[model samples]
Target: MPLRRVAALLLEPMSVFEYAVAAEVFGLDRTDDGVPAFEFITAGPAPGEPVALNTGGAIVPTHRWSDVLDADLVVLPASEILEEYPGELLEVIREAHARGATVLTICSGAFTLAATGLLDGKRATTHWRYLDLLARRYPEVDVTIDVLYVDNGSLITGAGTSAGIDACLHLVRRELGAGVANAIARRMVVPPQRDGGQRQYVRTPVPECTADSLQPVLLHVLDNLHEPHSVTSLAQRAVMSERTFARRFSAETGTTPHRWLLQQRVLRARELLERSDASVEQVAADVGFSSAALLRSHFQTIVGTSPQRYRRAFSTT
Candidate 1:
């Protein structure tokens, strides 16, 4: 069924940012921009009770917990981790999923969903800081630490902060269409899709580079993604040794030179597939891939779907 109604479940000590992310994505009326208007509501354990926020404010939800049972989609925003979650709340979550409604969690809200036992034997993610705790506490869950979000069929779990935006937009794109998702993204001033994942944001000590920065070279590579690039050639372009260039590149981009270039090529291919009347082979060559088969392999690996499927779902032309 198409997602026309959305219900956000609020818990005490909520992280305002995550709650706001849900509102920004689904609660706001965007019909003027050619996007469908979602029937959005907020539900809590006690209707009309004020829930304290982690950032020192409180919000009162107008709907009771029962309101979520029939919603097309339910959102769980981050809250302070509690020793025990309410059994009634967990039952509602399980029932919602059993009846074919989608459930999405933002940041630490994964803990609340996990309490329902629905996440057992499924891949999920949380804030990087609490990955170990979630894993240790819920041995049944397969915790993935490096991705911004995990879309395990109907259950979607987003990592910390802005990752919620990515997960929400992905769901909108999946359920509605790329045109609606893109319009919302434009109004919000954010990308409809993002490359790589949370792994790029992991903290690491980078060795300082004495030579000039590779910012210019990086921009040039992005501008000309159709051209073949190698560590040796990029090193020469930056006027540095391959070893120095590799180190600096990793330090600056959080990925190897080859991996970074491959990601960029895939992004370029996506753009061409969505905006141009090019065949798969043409897009492959235009993005520097050796063949359409190779492009399909890399595109599926990075985008989680085949090129043809993606274009069918999202193409503008």
Candidate 2:
């Protein structure tokens, strides 16, 4: 098999963290262990131009965006400013997709992809702070505000700065499986997988006077995420009907109460798995799962890896 080609779009005013993530994942030579390595190249909307990035550094592209007709993966690193996205940049993304390349974005880079209309009617995400702007600007897109990243086959969008590491690892895991991704994460000294979706960011503060509202209930749920609790019990404790509780919870948290709680549980479980010497069964019980089998199922499905593998790969020595 041939080595896959990956190109990162070095857009102007790029974020250093986002750019570093792509470089770390794709730019490094990892063929020492016979793993498939990507031919990583930094490209620009125009060739041979100095692209300003937020890192106080500038990148000069080896190729123009038009030169990437056959790249397997293309990345748009995050930026701080979304309102300054240029139309020419959107055109390049459109042309890239026309050739069937997988497009990935980090953090606010979703704003650039959303401008292309390719994210229309598709589930996508970005930095939690910009979800509302993305929703208002592109009402047709089903913006998932509570995901670390959304992989829609050909298009991928990440949540925040460090979440880009999770998104890239997820992509590596999908294309190369757990072992390869874990190896790469080890080389980079980052957790191969981070549990908990983007719901953690959705927990915005509520007024102190209205503390009895969903805020107090959410705090209770977070505090007891490792316990078996349900929406009905939480609603009863909060002195509101289930229907009213659900509505208010969604309005305040940007996701259903059930989904939010599950994410918190997963988050707590991952922490234990990474930090403790407990078996999967013990960790599962501590995190509210009925059994190790159930924990494994959810861990594989949502955490993107098995518990044992995550522990072995990420446990601090």
Candidate 3:
């Protein structure tokens, strides 16, 4: 279904950046660039009521909570986590989902969605800082860790301010196709595909080397993705032993060197597929995969679709 209508529920003590992420993606006028316009509205618990912002000052929402029920997409931006959200607000969100409106929560907004009982037995992720708490507090919800967002068909949750942008763009890509999603990303000057499985975890207490010390090697790998790289070679590039390098890489990237490189190669293949008329064989070579079959195997595992179908759905050329 086309996502033509959007309503963002404004909770008290709102995080300005997360709310702005929703507004900037959905509320902006982008039809001139061939991106469809969303009938975006911000609403409070009560119609025309003022909701307090954590950054200070109050925003008076012109739409009521009831208006959300009619929206095709309902946004829940990060707000202060509380033991309980207003019953009316929770019920309206519940009804909206029960009637088939797709619900997206940004960062700590997962807390609000959990209160509505929709996350039970479903995988969900919030900001990394609250990962443990979310898992412990909501035992029924299968709280996933180290992901930018979790998508379960009708419900999605994003982590942190930047991840919110990723989730919103991903939804646009899912519902409106890549051309529209890419157009909006171009307007916003952001990368359209930060895969949901990418890590958003914070620094851990595991005694480790300097954070991001492997950044140069990582950047070099990105620049030389077509080249064959191994843990030994990458470790040499970072001036560390293989064991130390592997540990540091995991600490920094939340994935092993092989898996990370595999993901990057597939992502590069996606871009090539979308923008260039490269055959799967050529794209596989371009992204450092040994053969088209290998690329297909890894691509399907990470992207949940084959290259040909992804290209057909998202290719611009």
Candidate 4:
């Protein structure tokens, strides 16, 4: 079904950035770009009531909880991560989902969805810092910590901050099409689709290494992704023994050398697929995979989709 109407649910002590993510994606009038316009409205617990924001300001929502029942999509933006959500708001979300409206959450908004028990026994994600807390609080929900977002049919959850943009665009692509999503992304000056997951943004507790220690080797590998690489070769370039290099590599990068190389290759393949008119075989070769078959295998594992399908969905051409 086409997503013609969208309603954003605002709670007290709201996050301005998360609220803006929804407004930017659905509320803006983009009819000139041939993108369909949505009837976007902000709904709160009390209609026409001013709610305090974490940014030291307040917003007066024009609609009440009942306004969301007819919306094609219902968005829950970040608010205080409370142990309990308002029962009235939860009922609204439950009714919307039961009526086939897509439910989406950004950041701590997952807590609100979780409160409705909709995320139970479902795969979901939120900001990396809160993964453990969320899992411990709700054991029934499968909280994925690595990915930027999780899409479970009618339910979608995004990680912190900018990841909300990725989730919003993903929904646009799913309900509308790649063309409309890409047009919105181009106007926002962001990539239509980002490669890899939130794992790349996670903070590791390992001690920092000297600036020049492994920087050169990492840069060289990125520049020479098509070339064969191994621990011995990379260690030699870094002027360290293989054993020492392996240990330090893991300490500095939070992953083994082989895994890091594979991730880089997959990222390069995604770039080529999106912006270049390259066949799967050529893209595989360019990214250092032995064959198109092997590339497909790794690409599917890392990206959750085949290269051909990814290109079909996101190719700029």
Give me the runs in candidate 3 sitting further than 4 Å from their true place. Answer: 195-201, 207-317
lDDT of 1 at 254: 74
lDDT of 3 by residue, 11-52 (tens): 999988999999999999988999887898999977767899
What's the lDDT for all of these models? 0.87, 0.80, 0.87, 0.89
What TM-score fits each model?
Answer: 0.66, 0.67, 0.66, 0.68
TM-score result, candidate 3: 0.66
lDDT of 4 by residue, 1-317 (tens): 66999999999999999999999999999999989988999998788898889999987898998888988999999999997888999999999999999999999999899989999999999998888989999999999976778999999999988899999999999889999999999988988898767654553332344647898898888899999999999999999999999998998888899988888898888889989998999999999999999999988777767788778767997
Count of clashing residue pairs in every prediction: 0, 0, 0, 0
Worst lDDT run of 10 residues, candidate 4, spans 200-209
TM-score of model 1 vs. true structure: 0.66
Candidate 2 residue runs with Cα over 4 Å from true position:
1-3, 201-203, 208-317
Per-residue C-alpha lDDT of model 1 across residues 1-317, encoded as one tens digit per residue? 67988988988998999999999999899999999989989899888999899989798998887878888999999999889998888888888888888999999999999989999999999998889989988999999876789999799999988999999999999988999999999999998997656644444332233445687787778787778889999999999999999998888777899988888888888788889989999999898998999999988776667788777756999
* Model 1 misplaced stretches (Cα beyond 4 Å): 205-317
Predicted candidate 2 versus true structure: per-residue lDDT over 1-317, tens digit per residue: 12289888877788888998999999989889555778999888777888897767788889987777678888988876566567776787888788788899999888889889999989998888888988998898899765789999889999888889898898888988899899898898988987666654444342232445667777777677668788889899889999988888777667787777666767777788778898889988887889999888877665656778767756874
| Candidate 4 residue pairs in backbone clash | none
- Candidate 2 has which clashing residue pairs, if any? none
**Model 2 lDDT-worst window of ten:** 201-210
